[model samples]
Target: MKVKSFLLTALAASMTFVACDNNDNEMGQLDNTPKSVSINLSNVISTRGAGQAIKDDSKVSLADLQVFFTNGTTLYKGKTVSGTEAVHYFSTKDDFDSRDDRVFHFLPAEVNKVIVVGNNGSKITEATTYADLQKKLAIAEQQDPQKLDLYKEVELTSVEGQDDLGHPLYKANVVLEPRVSRIEIGAFKYNAIAEGTPRKYTSIEVQQVMLNNYFTTADFQVGTASTVSKEEITAASVFGIFEKAAQAGATNPVWYSDVFSADKSADPATKLQVITLGVAAQYEHAYTEGNVRPAYHFFPKDDAIGTTNHPQVLVKLIGTKSDGTKEPLYLATSTFNPAVTADFAKIYVMNFEFDDEDLDNPQKCVEVTVDVMSWDVVPVTPEF
Candidate 1:
């Protein structure tokens, strides 16, 4: 049954969309007007199931973790916030787990909404456009960093003559880089609901494994690369959504399933599901090179069903009508990319939407798979 129908048109330009706070709220679409919100983040490394462990396979010490919020898609003037490193103080755990505290702030009056940029690059991978780096990141995060550790070596030493390029290993260049073990993010804040129900998510956790870096000396192996095919992009490939959902119960039960799709061709076309779910939650990893400069990557609030972000994501449906002519099925779904602050930590009660077509109740179950890919333009001169 078609639940209902409404036209969706995002009045703001996402890539160039500025903060819609008080400045432009009066001039834009009413539904997506920028509203006030508070964001909070909690780092629960110890309690998370992903098993928080730093993969310092490259012999690098963690300098610090900072979360950036941006009004524009890029992470420049956007509010910059740092995540507090919480050791074993908050919870009872074995080895110390570094986590973060909460950071919530009101949207600046000049911005429409905010977006987060999880800067995970020390060497600046943001130099790559959405096309080049998206695939690179997909492949890198999937690799096992343990191969480069020091303890895994056998005692076979090839003696090299100083003049002979043979056995003598050139004063081997030792490199230590921290591969993110576990990345956790939580609710910064949200639009207060009628009842005192706890907000959707308080935190999320991701894990990584790499060779340990504590050893003073050892043979460091050369780093390898990875590959990701278009086929590799699917719901199963997405690991952040379910992880977050398990942590936070659904404020909107099928929000993920509803907003994850690429069916711009659907009869109703792809549209945004703007449930009163004024609530938005996210957890993403900004992989850093040498552990600095992050490119924001976030998980949609209900992406377990399908990945969502920047305009909602959706999976389509195919149902038989009484007449039998194929109609643009309204999965009654769409993608939502909320405007976020620069801190990358604020849980802005997202006043965002997909200015797409109208959707009604979907008739039949449509077999669809949604893959959320995040990439951006790399200008000749980067602001940062």
Candidate 2:
């Protein structure tokens, strides 16, 4: 499937901060001069390969926006508001139309840096200093993967014009990026032929799928690269074990996870781990070339092409022979290859194909092809 990139257009209106006095003694002396400033926020979903850009707001929607004003050290506190209350919440796009909904009063001169977080839910609410907020933002909160988008602007430049009320106006164009990557499994195909005859299996039922050696936690801070030392890689929390029960009638199943750094070492004990898929009675159905497959989302990992740290996919299967005899089989992908590097804001489609060799030798790896593209683009029909 081919995907086209989309952009989250800038808010039609800016977040207007009314003049207010600062009383936080930890911030040192701050200029509380009365001034109103307007800040404009916009986001772009990055693209790769080849495709035309389109406008799609739903790709990256903002449930609420939290803005932090810092004087290069402590958070700038307003006279009557501090912590989360000072941030503005937008229940819907229409909320952006109301001036009252965008008002966040603060002393302009007291702020040297601006930090904006969107759709964060309640993970971060109160912080005394910039360092405190950094600590909170460093670790990703457990929530729906789609809602984890961060927008940051180190400095805000003031525009030449003022508002209708003669207050100074500030505007900034910032891009928002998802902290996680997505993996999609397209339709499944069974091409195995009988060992002695041309007859093939009547049906193949997929029981379970598992993703191994993926990162369970991610750092939400923008532009920070993921690095894990040998000692840290052995930590139990460094890798995640995720499994999903494939429903008999469901078209597709999806999983979300955090980013993982690549392990350069070749030591088997210290290298990245692989997971196994177990068969259970959750559900069972025959999957063919037109049936929608499953998908998994995770933090980007740069696993070398031939390294032990490369992530693998395991699938448990039940095959019905021509004579009606059912045989249990296991199919696993050697690795998510071609492009082992999983980056943020990208989508990877893994197509699984099984042949006679795979059916005869269940321990052998299946032939898997991977197709990668940018997220939010319209998907084309898969070539089975």
Candidate 3:
């Protein structure tokens, strides 16, 4: 039977996170008026292998976004107006100005630097140095309220005011880099039901997405957007899946209860199961100069490790036996790689394809494939 699946591919495109007026404002002449600037948020698209780009279909909110302004010595901070908590779904776009906090007051003088923190989980209001900012991020991830979707972005840049006519224009577009990777499992199923049995292979129920040994390494600086060395990407408790039970209103969620049915003759390529690993880190691939691939320190999936197994199991599949006993199916052997981009954000696609006669044997089943990608973060180029 011929089967077609979503092949992960890489595409070339440039993007930025800043939004400013086209007016050629000159900053040489400024009065006592403050500049009116708006905050913009967008994701850096990563280059894939050969598949089309998949949109960030999930919707997120900036309710907890934190803003900071500094001049290397003094610092100013504010919590921007919280727009729709979970308004719409899209990868990147300018946030709507729906709250009173949308308007910020900045002096017409030379503003040294500006920092924007997306989804601030640590309640970080201010920071003096890069190390301080890193510490704040670590603390936030540890105490992150494992919501349905948990992702964070941080952008930092130095800026001075611009003047068009006599108006002060000081808009600093802070591009946020993703701190975590999103692993989604699609087409998950196994051949278990007997050919003539009354119980047809309808669906496979997933307990939860699990990863044995996972960790995150420091790729770029929060203050300067500079890449760090391996020595910098230390073992600082930056690994593991998001706390499942911590998710609101999720009580024993059967992640994927519905199975996909496809006509092999008509549509040779059909996906049978879809599962999302939620938030996870990609295992490190050897680092290379000028080449950006999300690489973390390799941590073997040691089931009998010093850590607890309350929520570290990557993928758990339970199949029905001929005798009607529901037993958990262990992956005899598997090959899966999570995609990591240049800036450290990721898209891990878990491909599970059942062999033609695997259902007839049921003992040996499935091959897991993983794809990784790299990307560069730039300013957004608006289209007409």
Best by TM-score: 2
lDDT of 3 by residue, 64-144 (tens): 444555545454442222422222222222333344344444422333455555444445534655345553122112111
Number of backbone-clashing residue pairs for each candidate, in the order shown: 71, 3, 29
- TM-score of each candidate structure, all chains considered together: 0.20, 0.57, 0.42
| Better lDDT candidate (2, 3) | 2
Cα lDDT tens digits, model 1, 1-384, are 010100000000111111213222234323432223222222212110111112211121112222223333333222223423212111111111233323222333333322322223232334222122222223123112221111111111221232121111211111122211111111111222335644322321112111111111111121122221111123343334433432332353221122322343432222322111122332222222121110112221221212222222122323233354433222211322222112111111111121112223222111222211111111110000
Indicate whether candidate 1 or candidate 2 has the larger TM-score. Answer: 2
lDDT of 1: 0.21
Candidate 2, residue 133: lDDT: 58
* Model number with the top lDDT: 2
* Candidate 3 backbone clash number: 29
Count residue pairs with overlapping backbones in model 2. Answer: 3
Candidate 2 lDDT, tens digit per residue, 1-384? Answer: 111112111011123332223322244443455433344443422222111222222344455666667777786643322424443444434454454534455445667556666666654557757776552232123223334555554555534455555454555444555555544444345653444444345666654555554555455654333442121121132222222222311344224221111333433222211221112311122223222234444455454422544445655566776687987665556545454454554555555665556656634454345544544322212221
